[model samples]
Target: MTLQPTLPARVEKDRTTPPRSGPSRRRDSRYEALTGYLFVAPAVVLFLVMGLYTVGYGFTLSFAKWNGFAPNWEWVGLDNYKDLLWRDPVYAPRVRHAAANTIWVMVAAPVLTVVVSFPLAVLLNQVKRFQGVLRSVYFLPYVTSGVAVFFAWQYILQPDGAINSLLSGLGLGSLQQPQGWLGNPSTAMPTMIMITVWGHVPVAMLLYLTGLQGIDRSILEASELDGAGWWRTNMSVVWPLVRPITAIVLLLNLREALQGFQTFLVMTNGGPGDHTNVLGLEAYRLAFLKNLSPTLGLASALGWLLFAAALVLALINLRALRSKT
Candidate 1:
């Protein structure tokens, strides 16, 4: 038996060993490249890490009753969420008010921007001298800080802010009077919306300008040859071409409006009352302002709900764009 086994030891070993080839080696290299690409995917990697930390932590915190810095906390299940939804009177309406304000901002910012900016862009485009300078000057507010910004605007809107100052010069009503530009409920939302629009119009103008530059001169010439007036050309030619840019500008404005905490925090702090409250400001109050005990659960739930709404809106926009295309 030993002799029979020893007859072809090399052959037996060769039969037992696995085989390797050029194609196999090449396949192995490709496999490695695939994994390497995944490792280096900046966006995917960043999303995973950031999402895991933010979304996961937020979700976890929602179920626990944690104070600002205290390590001692208890599992509260859906209690916080229930409290925000129905049980707690203060937080419930605050969320509703905040949502309404956010919607106003979202609608007002971009629409007002389009109304104010399109003409400005056209005017600026036509100008030969200091055009770029004017555009830059207008765009300054987009890059400005919210902290000092609100104060300036507050003064202007103040019983004696800029608007008041001009009004007083013109012998109009005083801004410093108890008219409640910010303090009163009726004007608060509108005031915030105007602020939102004023701050964002520059961005809309810039994007519209960029899109306008991309319009073919030949197309405009052709439209003019077809007896199209300025309005006709805009509706039939320029507007259609600039649709994508408009959508993008609107999307940006919507995001900003939905995240409308800065305006609330700086100027109104969600109001002299809850007049300017939006979900964003309410979330802030629940999470940070109210107590050492955070309403993380409700905040997270509200955040997810808002995110879902935004996603739906975005999808709707995308689908509409696709249909147009």
Candidate 2:
């Protein structure tokens, strides 16, 4: 009494639908390729004009003295490089001082970023309730406007500002700087380093968190079951596994510390009498802000020197990371 409908063993092809011919396929592919190129054309053109062209021009300009506006560029050969590298008495000493300061920052910032951020990231990864809120809070600094935050920090580090007031309230009044933190040459550099670390920690922590999340939960559990403590599990197991992330964070922070001048420009303007002056600010100062006598060639030479140092350090880091891996 029951009728069961049986399905067809083979479904018939649609004879009315023609397969795409070779020429049509090729034409479609060509159209797709053209569309993709058109999509990227603006970015490619911009890079050619603003990035490569500017770099080439800067490289060429390094050998010529120009006020950045003059029609005639005086070809100075290697004089600009020589002066910055220790030929001119005035420029050489400043350059050396800036180089030293730059090196200090370049080494310290990335190290501190790792030291602070990794611990914070580990702790954050363990967080459960309100985790999203906490992460957003941590990430705020990275997303916040740099100039505004730097200005706020400048205010906070001032003599009568919140930091000094807090110190006084805590009965650490002796530690309070009457001349303001940034006003004192002794404290200026360290304070800036601290700010840099604080600003950088968020991004580094986020990277570490991402790396930590990618780790297998079973691996962590196995480590725990094998009588490994939290510290040992993280140090010996987790940290090693997160080496790639750590390398990325370190390289990024290193590059930033090497090339950054915005914070110094905003907060101290390379002052407390050049105590916080770095090669980045020095280059900027030479190119644009040296009492209307902008040494465009000298600035370009300094910029190239900075570029060389960055390239060498990057290569060294990559090599070391590869060796470890």
Candidate 3:
């Protein structure tokens, strides 16, 4: 009985339904965009004021000679850059030494970190009991206070420190360093490299562990079924799958090595005759530690040079990764 009017009622309802207005939709989109801009405005303003402005100011300052309290910045043109290159004899050798040490750290630290951390990650991944506890333990040093850790390490590497004590107890007293690991020119750089590697291992391990967990169990099982041993499977199959993670770890390690000087500063202070000097420490010394004769211009120039080197190396890394892909 109701079917008699159903078709007419449906048609009427359809005709009466309001069409979506283009202006309304456009307004809604604009509103959303405005809201997004408002939310991000604070961050953008802060970056421009704090980061970009300071960077630009530093670049300008790099072209001028300025003691920290000078009434006016003395225009020096490219003199600061030239000084770092070869012009200033005192500055030139220090820069060269720091540059060499920086390069060594950049290359050695990342490689050692990767070599040490990946295996630890694999082992940790296989752990079934107290996995969380073990992971926390490994990561603890990374989260600990850097100054405290550096001091602890400094104590540990001292002449009569625990390491030498242990060496003596093991009847390897001949191998012990009486000058302390950090004080000896021969051992200082290597010891610093090892400490850098140690500091980075936890991060790399965590990354690898996450990557390993994300891998398909079926692929692993199939590899085992195909008579592949653990090492073989991991090296051949697992490593390839975890290349992305490896890249991240390598980049982070490289950045840290290139930019970090805190550990060396705290532990060695570029001592043993500049054996552990790095670019970052040199820059810091130039900028702040010069007392009344602050070479802020030279420090800024060095900072820019360091930035350029880091950019080049990072670009190379990215290019290599892309080509692999």
RMSD of candidates 1 onward, in order: 10.7, 3.7, 3.0
lDDT by residue (tens digit), candidate 1, 109-207: 778878888877877777889988998999999888867888888877766456656666887764434654776677878888888888888889998
Off by over 4 Å in 3: 1-32
Distance from true location, Cα of 50 in model 3, Å: 0.6
Supply every candidate's count of residue pairs whose N, Cα or C atoms clash at under 3 angstroms: 12, 0, 0
- Candidate 2: residue 248 Cα off by (Å): 1.0
lDDT of each: 0.78, 0.93, 0.93
* Order of candidate numbers by TM-score, starting with the best: 3, 2, 1
Give per-model TM-scores: 0.81, 0.90, 0.91
Please tell me which model should have the higher lDDT, number 1 or number 2: 2
Give one digit per residue, the lDDT tens place, for model 3 in 1-325.
Answer: 4555445434344556586699988999999999999999999999999999999999999998888898999998999999999999999999999989999998999999989999999999999999999999999989999999999998999999999999999999999999999988999999999998888999899999999999999999999999999999999999999998888888898888888999989999999999999999999999999987849999999999989988987898899899989
Candidate 3 has which clashing residue pairs, if any? none
Deviation in angstroms for 185 in model 3?
1.0
Question: Highest TM-score among the candidates is held by which one?
Answer: 3
Pick the winner on lDDT between candidates 1 and 3.
3
Q: Estimate, for each residue in 222-245, the C-alpha lDDT of model 2 and write its tens digit.
A: 999999999999999999999888
RMSD of 3: 3.0
